[model samples]
Target: MPILWLTVIVLALAALGYVIGRRRALASGDGRIRNLHSLPSYYGSYVAMMTGVPAISLMLLWLLAQPFWVNSAVLADLPVSAVADGSSSSLVMSDVRRLADGLDRAVAQGVMTEADIDAMGSDLSGIRTRLGNVGVALGSDVSTDILTSAQDYRTKAATGRLVMSILVLAVAIVGFGWAYQRTHKDFRARNVVERGIRYVLIAAACIAILTTIGIVLSLVFNAIAFFRVYPASDFFFSLTWSPSFGGGSELGILPLLWGTFYISIIALLVAVPIGLFSAIYLAEYAGPKVRGVAKPLLEVLAGIPTIVYGLFALLTVGPFLLGIFGPDGVGWMQAGTAVITAGLVMGIMLIPFVSSLSDDIINAVPQALRDGSYGLGATKSETIRQVILPAALPGIVGAILLAASRAIGETMIVVLGAGAAARLDLNPFEAMTTVTAKIVSQLTGDADFSSPEALVAFALGMTLFIVTLGLNVFALYIVRKYREQYE
Candidate 1:
C-alpha cells in the first residue's frame, strides 16, 4: 500500500511540477524560454523527483527502523527472562511481535473471549519456552496490538508521505503561479526549470547503467560459483556432453555446444542468402508501395514468438522430416526431429531479423553514390551491386551477428525442436542436444542445486552469456568500423 501510494504521489507531483513549469516558461514570453535548453517534461520530472524521492526514501528507512525500535521498547517492559537469553533476538523478536499482533486482532474483531487473551499469553510463553530451540523455523511471539500498532504506524507514515508529496506538488504549483503572476521582463522561470530537469535525465541514465551492472554482477557471481564446482576445461574443451542425474555425471558440455553451433550454422546458411536478397529487393528493386507493404510483413517473422517456431518444429516440421528419411526411401535422415528441422524453422524465424536490419543499412547507403555509378552508364543491378552492398556490408555483418545472438539465446525453439540427446554425432539427421537443452533438462523436477547436475545450469548459462557478449562486441566493432567509413 505504501509503495502504491508512493508511486501515485510521485506521478502526481511530477505532473503538477511539469504543468507549472511549462506554464511559467510559456508566460515568460522570452526568447530564452523559446530557445530553452531541454524538454518541458524535464522540469516536471525534476520537481517530481524532488518531492517523491527523498520522502519515499525516508519512509522506507522509517519503516525498516520502526519495527526494531517498537520491538525493543516493548521487550524492555517485559521480564528479563522474557527476552529469552538473547539466543534468538531475531526469532524471539518476531514471536513477541506476533503476540502483540494477536492481542490487537482480538480487539479489532470484537473477540473479548478469555481464549483470545489466552492465545496472546501462549504466544509469549511459546517464545520463552522455545528459546533454546530457536532457529529458522520460529516465526513470531507478540501480541495483536503491537503488530497492529506497527501496521497502523506504517500506514500513517505512508499517508504522511502522500500528504507531503501532495503538499510539495501544491507548493510547486502555487510557487509557479505566483511567480508567473509577477512575471516581469526579467523573469527566468524557464531557465530555472530546465536546469532542474537536465539533472533528472542524468539520474535516469545512471539508474539504467546501475541496473545493467547489477544484472552482470549477479550472473558473474553464479558463474564463479559454477566454475568452482565444474572445471572450466570440461565446460569449454570436452566435446562430449553427457550430464548425469543419479549415476556419475560426465557433464560434458561439448555435445550441447555442437548442437547449438550446428543449428546456428544451418540457420545462418538459410538466412544469409534469403535475407540478403529480401533486403536488396526492398532497397533497390521494390517500389515504394511494395516496400511499404513488404517491410512490415517481413518484420512479422521477428514478431512471431520462438515458442511458435518450436511448436512448428515439433508438431509440423519434425514429423514431416522424419517421414522423408525414416529408414524407408533413402535413409539419409535419421528422424523428423533432427538438427535440420530446428535449424530450418529457426532460419525462417530469423529471416525478418536479417532482412529488416539489412534493409535499413542498405537504404542508408548514399543515393548520390548510386547516381554517380548510373551516370557512367552502369545498369541498375550493376550500380547497386557495386555501390550499395559494399557500403552496407559491415552493417550487414553486424546484423547477422545480432541474429546469431538471438539464435544462441533462443531456448524455447531448441527445447522443442532439437532432440533431447547428448551425442557428438556428425549427422544433422541424428538427434543432437545443445547447451540450452542441457540447462533446461538439468533443472527440471526435483532439482538438486548443490549437486553437480543442478550446478551445470549455471555453467551453461555463463557460457551462453559469454558467447552472446562476444558476438555483440564483435558486431559493435564491425558496425563502428562501417559507420566510420560512411561518416
Candidate 2:
C-alpha cells in the first residue's frame, strides 16, 4: 500500500513538474521569433520523466527486497532453538513470525509471568520501532549492533534511491537545457529528441529481450533436471499422463498437449468468425457514437474475470451437456465438462480480445485501396472482402495469433472449466486436461519436489514457453513485414 501511494505521489509530482516547466518555457519564449531553448512540451516531458521514473524504480526495488530484509531481521532476533535445523527461508521466516506474535499474545493473555512478559514485549517493540526508524536513516545508527544493522539496511536503501533519482533528474535537466540552449534558426532540437527517443525505444526492446532470455534459461535448466530422471521419448510420445505419486511415475506430454490443443482449437473456431465480423462492422459500418458505445461494450467482455468464465463453464454448460449426453438421452454433445464446453465459454471470453485487435488492423488498411475497389464498381462487402482484408491480412493474422497465445496460456478458465484428468482423447466432449491444469495438479497440497511427478512440471513449462514464444515470434514477423508493405 505504501509503495503504491509512493508511486502515485511520484507520478502526480512528475505531471505537475511537467505542466510548470512547459508553462515557464512558453512564457519566456518570443512567439514572433525563435528562442534559445527547447519547445515547451520537451521541457515539460523532461521534468515528468525525471520526477516519475527514478522514484518508481526505487519503489520497485524496495518492493522486491522488503520481505527478504524483514525476514532476515526477524530471524536474527529469534532464539537459536526456534530454527535450529537448516530450514528453508520460507519455513524459518514463518516460524519466527509465529513465535513473535505468539509471545505477544501470551503476554496479553497473562499466560507468562510479569518479568518475561515485559522483556518479550520490549524486544518485539524495539525491533519494530528500529525497523521503522532505519527506513529513512543515513550512515548507521551506531548505537548498538542490531540498531546498526537496521540503519545500514535503511541507509543503503535510501542512498541507492537518491542516486537513481539524481541520475534520472540530471539526464532530464541536461536534455532540456541542451535543447533549450541550441534553439536558434538552424537548430533542430526536434531531430535530437527524436534520435534520443529512438535510443529509448531500443533500450526498451533490450529489456524485453533480456527478460525473455532469463525466462528461457530458467525453464531450460529445470527441464534438464527433469530429463535426467524421465526419458524424453516417454514424455513426448507416451499417450497417457498418469503422474507417479511416490515410487515410480510416468510423465507424458501427449495427454496435456491433446487437451490444450482441443480446447484452443474449439476456442479459435468460435472466436474467429464473431470477432472478425465485429471488427469489420466496427471499422466500416458504425457511426462515431455507435462505435464509441459498442467498442467499450465489447471490451467489457475482456474485463469479465476468468473465474467467472470458469464457473459459467462448470455450473451452466457442464451440467447442460451432461444431461443430454449422460447415456439416457439423445447425445448431441458428450458432456459439459468436455473440451467443447470450456472452449466455447473461453471463446466467448476472447471475442473482445480478437475484435479489438482486428479492428485496429482493419482500420490500418489504406483508404486508397478501398477507393480503387469502389472505382472498379466493387460493392461495400466486395471492397472489404477483396482489397481491405487482404491488405490487412498480415496484421489480422498477427491479431489472431496474439489471441491464440492468450488462449493457450489461459489458466483459470481451464482449471475450473476443463476436467483434471490428463489423457489423450480425440473426443472434445470427453473429459480432458491441459498443461496448466496439470501444473496446478502437480503442485498441490502433497507435492514432492524430488519426485519425477513434481519435476515433470518444469518440462511441461519449457514446452509451453517454447510454443508461446514461437507463436509470438511468428506474429511479430508477419506484422513487421506487413507494416513495411504499408509504409
Candidate 3:
C-alpha cells in the first residue's frame, strides 16, 4: 500500500479505538461518569495514543531502513563486471535505480506489462525507447546485468512495502485490542497518557541534539578525508585560492578567509552604528506611536529574503558604485561587482538583526538605573550613556555578535555583489569571494566526491563552523561576565 493510504488507515483505526474505548469505559461504569477514576476522554485518548504512536513509529523506522536494505541487497546481487569503465560503482548503482524507477513508471503508465518486462532480455534498445516514451531518460545504455539488478531492486522494494503495510496494520490492531481491553473504570488513563506525552517531548529534544551532533561529525569526518589528501598547513597558510578538478588544484583557504573577514568587518562597520543609534532612538526617545510604527517598519527588512537583498545589490547598488568608482570617475573599480557593493548591501540586510535585538536589550535595562543617574543630576543623554548603555552592554554585544555571524554566513549577497574571485587585496573596490560562497561553488556540479577539490567544501564548512563557534563562545563569556556584574 502507498504510505498515504497506510497512514489514513492507522489514523482511522485510532479514531475508532477512541470511540470504542470511551464507550467501553462508560459501559464499565454503568454509563455513570462518577464511577470512573479518570475522565472518559482520557480513556479514549489513551486508546488512540497506543493504537497510533507505536504503529507510526514502526512505520517511520521501516521507511528509513528500507532503502539501505534494498540497495545493499541489489548491489550484492549485481556482478562486479556490470560497472562500465571510467565509472564508479556508485554511478552504476545510480543508473540501476533510475532504470528501476523508469521501468516502474512504464508499467504504471500501461506502456508495458509484468509479462512483457519479464520476457525482456539483455538488449536495452527497445527498453530505452519505451522508458523514453514514459519520460524517463537514462545517462547511458542499460546493460543486461544492470537490467537484472534493477528488476531485483523493484521486486524487493515492492515486497518490502507490502510487508511494511501488513506489519504496521498488525501493530495498530494489536495496540487497539490491548488498549480496549485495558479500558475500565479503575484505570489511570490520564497519568499514562501524560507520561507518554512527556516521553514524546523528550524524544523530540533528543532528536534535535542528535541532529546537531550528526552534522558536526559529518563535517569532521569529511574534513579529515580532505586533509588526508591535501595538507592542512597549505590550506591554512597559503595566500591563494584555486581549485581545479583536473589536478594540482591549490586548495588554500587563506584568501577565502580574508575575503570573508573583510566583507564581514565592512558590513559590521556600516551596520553597527546605524543599527545601534536606531535602537537607541526607538527604545529610549521615540513616542509610543512612533515606536510602534518605526520598529515594525525597520524589522520588515529582516523579513525580506536574502536573495532579494542580493538582487538589490546586483542591480542597484553595484551599478551605483560603479558609476562613481569606475572609468567614469576615480577609475578605481573595474566592475560593478566588488567587495564594497556586497559589504554595504549585506550590512543593510543585517540592520534588523542588530536594531531589533539591541532595542529589546536596551528596553530590558532597569528604569531604576536611569532614575539613579538622573538623581545624580545627569542629563538624559548622560543617563543613557552612563547607566542604561552600560547595563545593556552585554546583551548589545551578543546582538552584535549575532549580526557578525549573519554577515559571515551570507552567500547570495556576496555572490551577486562581489564577483567570484578569491584574492588577498586591501582595496574595497576589488572583487572577492567569501568562504560560504566558495563552499557552494566547490560542491556544485558533477565533481568527484573523493577528490580533494570536492571534499574541501567540508573543510571550508568546518573552518566556518569553528569561527562561528568561537564568536558565540566569546559572546557568551562577555554576557556572563557583565550579567553577573549587573546583577
- TM-score of each predicted structure versus truth: 0.71, 0.68, 0.95
For model 1, the local distance difference test gives: 0.70
The lDDT, on a scale of 0 to 1, for candidate 3 is 0.92
Candidate number with greatest TM-score: 3
lDDT of 1 by residue, 200-221 (tens): 6887898899988987887677
lDDT of 1 at 358: 91
Candidate 1 accuracy as TM-score:
0.71
The candidate that wins on lDDT is 3
Residue 446 in model 2: lDDT:
57
Model 2: how large is the Cα RMSD against the reference? 8.3
lDDT value, residue 70 of candidate 2: 61
Model 1 Cα RMSD, 1 decimal: 8.3
In terms of TM-score, which candidate is stronger, 1 or 3? 3
Alpha carbon deviation, residue 463, candidate 3 (Å): 1.0
Tens-digit lDDT string for candidate 2 (1-487): 2345545656777787677756655656654225735565676665565556555655666556655766565556645553445444455444344444443444456555446534544354554443343342222211233333333334444455555455544544554444444434334435555665687689789889999899889878888988998899999988877876866676779889888988998999999999999999999999999999999999999999899899999999888877877665666555567787889898999899889999998898888899999999999999989899989999999988988988998888898777787876777777888998887777775554656787888889989988988999999999999889987
Q: What is candidate 2's local distance difference test score? A: 0.72
The 10-residue segment of model 1 with minimum total lDDT is 129-138
**Candidate 2, residue 407: CA error in Å?**
0.9
Model 2 regions lying over 4 Å from their true place: 1-213, 332-335
lDDT by residue for model 3 over 1-487, one digit each (tens)?
9999999999999999999999999999999999999999999999999999999999999999999999999988888778646667787788889999999999989999888888876557778888989999866656778888898999999999999999999999999999999999999998999999999899899999999999999999999999999999999999878899999899899999999999999999999999999999999999999999999999999999999999999999999999999999899999989999999999998899899988988887878888888889999999899888888988899889989988998999999999999999999999999999999999998988899999999999999999998888887787677667656
lDDT of each: 0.70, 0.72, 0.92
lDDT of 1 at 382: 92
